[model samples]
Target chain A: MHEFSLCEGIIDAITAQTCQQGFSRVRRVWLEIGALANVELDALRFAFEVVREDTIAASAELDIITLPGRAWCLNCAQTIAVGELYDPCPLCGGYQWRLTGGNEMRIKELEVE
Target chain B: MCATCGCGETEPVIHPHDHAPDHAHPHQHDHAHDTRRISLEQDILAKNAGFAASNRRLFVEQGVLALNLVSSPGSGKTALLSRTVQILRDEFPVAVIGGDQQTANDAERIIAAGAPAVQINTGKGCHLDAHGIGHALERLALPKGGVLFIENVGNLVCPADFDLGEAAKVVILSVTEGEDKPLKYPNMFAAAKLMLLNKTDLLPHVEFDVDRCLDYARRVNRELDILQLSARTGEGMEPWLEWLRRGRHDALIQQINQLEADLAAARSRLIHGGGAIRRTVI
Candidate 1:
């Protein structure tokens, strides 16, 4: 799965931060994953655990925050909240929807020493 | 123990008594370390995105129209790329960065077709990330106004998530595959802007429903541009070639437009500052 590669990216980012922030051990990580980011939470957790082995975050706890998906409905002329990319507009039942939000995966904070 | 060389025969260093807590907790622990909270607020994919941005900048600087070609394992990507290179190599300089799990066969094929090519054998990587492509760019001498085709590892899933700094992701689907490939792999179809339905020459011999396939692809990406072609028989190659020409033309136009805007801004600044302002060509 791509989760392993994504976790590699996360670890690289964290390692880079450790150099600039002067931290040796990371105890916890808080991540914000959007609904439409196309990442499976369990898969990410598994990947993170495997990737963090023997690193600064070996015993770190992962905290995940999910964001909702938002899209623009062309027919309804309004912004609508969607749960998936292929969903139709809830207000007008139209498929002419454009994605607007909830397509992000970011690390928000870290507890380190 | 000495910090320099831990021989375990030195006096142990201890913290001052004042630094110790007054009382131990109900569930006491030996390690009493103070943790610090740091606010990062950074995208996890920032590293990849940074590489991608740099690749895009390099492409613009070189006026190279880069395209990432993706498809299943046997979707005729190499053939189409070879054919495209053979036909257009005389007109414009072209290069290729072929990705695969092993072997340099595709790169060799592209080279034989009369184009500069390099093979990136990803040991275990399913898709070509931006960082890999950036390294490949270092090895390739892509001329200005040339085309760089990056043939990704034959995967329709993982490549959908990675940004390779291409002008567009072109998915090539052959007639031998299922017509509902777009529906099955929606992410790939959704990410691609163009779908080349290759192997049209075999349409009569095979039971591939062209209309149904297009319908399924359109269902996922309504704005996708579809081109039917057969790299084997040179049928319907004009549209595909035209598409490449247009991409290069559009990139040139964009560069000209940016230079003109930069010039205008520089002129205004010079007019206001009595010729002391420096010109910025971004």
Candidate 2:
């Protein structure tokens, strides 16, 4: 599963960060998961918890922020928010809309003390 | 911090050196503490980026032209790669790393078409990553002038996020699938370097719009190389084959030169490490 591997990556990143900063404990972790990233936040969190034990981030709390899918219509020349990716530009009914933002899974920040 | 530990809890033992009287039992207060709000603006994948960059560096040093192919189930990725194996087998030394959920079908197809192929059954995994490819390469025994082709598992959305040490990333879409695929899944298209509109032989009977497919791909990736071809009929394969050959040749020559240099350096290193100048270059 992508979530399982992504959870492994998260654990690796968190481990490397804590080791580098000399922080033996991670208090909180913030992840910015885009709506279009196709990542199930719940599954990812569950995987993270299962794999993060015995690491500095074992006691960490996960905070996720969901970003809405967004795209820019070339004909309309304006960025618009849509429920799905290709919702035919709401302003001009143009199908040729370029995705500008959203659609990614990244950890926003980590709080260590 | 646990309410009782404070990083100094010792099995709730008496502090061996305590000379003062013990305090009364804990109070039964019911006051609720407010939630802690912390500000952190960091990306979770920020760490993987470093390893990805190193993988790219290794790819560049090895001078291998790696291409990661992504597509949906029954999208003809195997067919397209099998076609490439036949076309580029003699033109460019090539190898393939196949990813699938089960069985070595794709790898067998490429091997049957005459090329070195290694199957990576991700089992429950949805995509291929650089580390997996690196591990696969150790078993492939590829030499200089070798072109690496990685066929990711049949998934569009999950494979886009991974950078698998590839020189190019391709998204294969057959006309049998709906025309609204690119519109529906923008991330996969955006991540691809080119989009192969496979099975174009059925264009006449199907409701697929070649122009619409190209337009959608270009809309997402402004520089998307849109190639419309049918792996079955070999229709519209000339340009695709030519482009592939040119790319592989360019990368192979570089690899050959790098290997020669490495051999020379190793000889010189041996000479300087207390050995005579009896270096022989065959």
Candidate 3:
């Protein structure tokens, strides 16, 4: 699954940060996931559990913060909430909308000792 | 901020060193816990995206049209690539990178079709990431104003998320598969820019409905480009070849435009009596 690869990405990012931030063990990880990022939370957790072994975040707790998806309606010239990528613009009921936000998965903070 | 870990502490701590030496302090060594909170706003896919960006830059600099071909197993991706390479090799420089779980058979086929090919054995990996593509590109040199076809592992799921710095993702679907495959694997279909319905010769023998299949694909991606071609029998290959030629031509034009802009900038710097004259060679 792509979730497994994405978990690897998270581990890579954490490991790289450890070298720069001089942290050895990660106790907690605060991650921000967008609503339209298409990541299944359960699958991501399962993948993280499988991948976190032998890493600094092995015992870390994952705290996820979800952001709502937003898009810019081209016709109506308004920002509207979008549940999916292919969803029509809520304001004008048109499909010609550009995604403005909520398509990212980022690590916001970490608690380390 | 706490001195030991430099974290923001909400509760006030009693200062032991500020008191008399004989004064007993219970929380004297409490800071030894040394827990720290680090605020790091970092994208999880940054590493992969960085590699992909580098690959894209290299491709653009080299004027190479790199296409990532994705499909399920037995979708005839290798066959399509091999045939396409054979047809285009005389007019352009072509190379292929084959991704598979184990064997190098696809790479061998591409080579047999008369083009340089590198096989990336992913071992247990389900898809070829940008890092793997970077390594493959290092081994295989893509020609200027040519095509570089990256045949991804025979998977429709994991490959959809990983971008290998390709100009476009070309997905292949065979006629033997269900017509509703686009709906079943919407992620893959949605990620692809082009859908090549391969093995059209088998359509007469199979129960595949072309219209329904196209409708399903359109539902997933309304702007997806579709082409019907039988890679084996050389049927409906004209449009595919034309598309490749068009892509290569556009890449060449882009290289030319970039060179012209750089030259103009350098000329302006010289006219302005800059300290040193820097020349860029394409």
Give the top-scoring candidate (lDDT).
1
DockQ score of each predicted structure, in the order shown: 0.42, 0.28, 0.40
Which prediction has more favorable lDDT, 1 or 2?
1
- Candidate scoring better on TM-score of 1 and 3: 1
lDDT string, candidate 1, B30-137, tens digits: 456767799989988887788788788778766788999999999999999999999899888899999999999999999999999999998888889897887777
Which pairs of residues have clashing backbones in candidate 3?
none
- If the candidates were sorted by their DockQ against the true structure, best first, what order would they fall in? 1, 3, 2
What TM-score goes with each of the models?
0.84, 0.73, 0.83
Candidate 2 wrong stretches, greater than 4 Å: A35-38, A53-55, A66-104, B1-43, B46-48, B249-282
- Model 3 ranges off by over 4 Å: A35-38, A68-102, B1-30, B34-36, B264-282
Model 1 lDDT vs. the true structure?
0.85
Cα displacement (angstroms), candidate 1, residue A69, comes to 3.1
List model 1 lDDT by residue over A50-102, tens digit each: 98887778999999999899988888889999876556679987668777788
TM-score (chain B only), all candidates: 0.82, 0.74, 0.84
Task: Report the number of the highest-DockQ candidate.
Answer: 1
Ten consecutive residues with minimal summed lDDT in candidate 1 chain A?
Answer: A15-24
- Tens digits of per-residue lDDT, candidate 2, A1-113, equal 57777877777666655333434467788888888776778888888888778766788888888888788877888998866654667898766677666776777777765
DockQ versus reference, model 2: 0.28
Q: Report the lDDT tens digits of candidate 2 across residue range B17-110.
A: 2344344422222443222333435455554455456555666676767788899999988888898788888876788899998998888989
